[model samples]
Target: MDIEIFPYRVLGSDTTEALLNDLESLEDVKRTVIHGPRFPKGEATLPPKYRERRVININGEDVVLQVKTARIFLEITMESTIDEIEEICKEHIPYGFDINQDRSNYIRKQQTVTDRIKYGDKELPDELVGMTDQYSTFDDHVKIIKKDD
Candidate 1:
């Protein structure tokens, strides 16, 4: 059993409210919270002042635009695998949006490599390695050749 955190940001408040309402209707979404610097328990936080403030020229007058930032926090339980979790999230969330997994010990381990073979280093023995059927030698190493017509 593994726990995964999914973060989503909806630009407008209307969209955020709609998404939250949809999630609340689902039983699988156990808990949802807004995250922000001011309110740690909230589901989302206001956009930073720097980002919210913008200057634009409108009709010979300078207009300042303030944009609000908000995000939703979903704590999901993964019984199958990370790929399965991502699929579920994609199915629920809309297109052109971003979804990211929260930082965890498992992710850290997978991302950080303790030992890496540098250029010109001796390749590991084949007996100690496992071949993956999904990959092809030709796909792994592609050569650019000119065609002589």
Candidate 2:
């Protein structure tokens, strides 16, 4: 399976930078790239051209971190199961952050399978549903799911 993982968060001046610095220190991470508003304004408020890419505030400042958005991409050649993928994600993703995957093509194919099963054209098997919840650029509305250590 081929997969891409995007992990992102909003933190308070220098905090985002500090987090990026800390991320760079991690041995598991292969690369880290930082991008913000072309010119800093305040948090979440970006130049119109970059507005669509906005995620949330960066450390009391109105900035979104793109490095956090493009964390890792993997191509699994072995027979690892989906559980293994989920475990890897949980291990690397920071707390109180959001993760998104550009799996539109995968979802579309799953939908076809789902439809076939609904029509009795095929047997119903285990299914996975992908849904995205509304998020704010301020990070005020989102809550993180805690994991057992």
- Those runs of model 2 whose alpha carbons end farther than 4 Å from true positions after fitting are 1-10, 40-95, 101-149
lDDT per residue for candidate 2 within 1-149, as digits (tens), equals 33444446433324444453333333333322333333344525766654333544422334443332334333333333334545544554546443334553222214354344433454433221211112323233222222123
Tens-digit lDDT track for model 1 on 39-63?
2333235555424333333223343
Q: Where does candidate 2 have its weakest 10-residue lDDT segment?
A: 127-136
Error of 1 at 62 (Å): 37
Say which candidate scores most in TM-score.
Answer: 1
Mark the regions of model 1 whose C-alpha exceeds 4 Å error after superposition: 1-10, 36-69, 79-95, 105-149
Q: Pairs clashing in candidate 2?
A: 11-59, 12-59, 12-60, 42-62, 43-61, 43-62, 43-63, 44-62
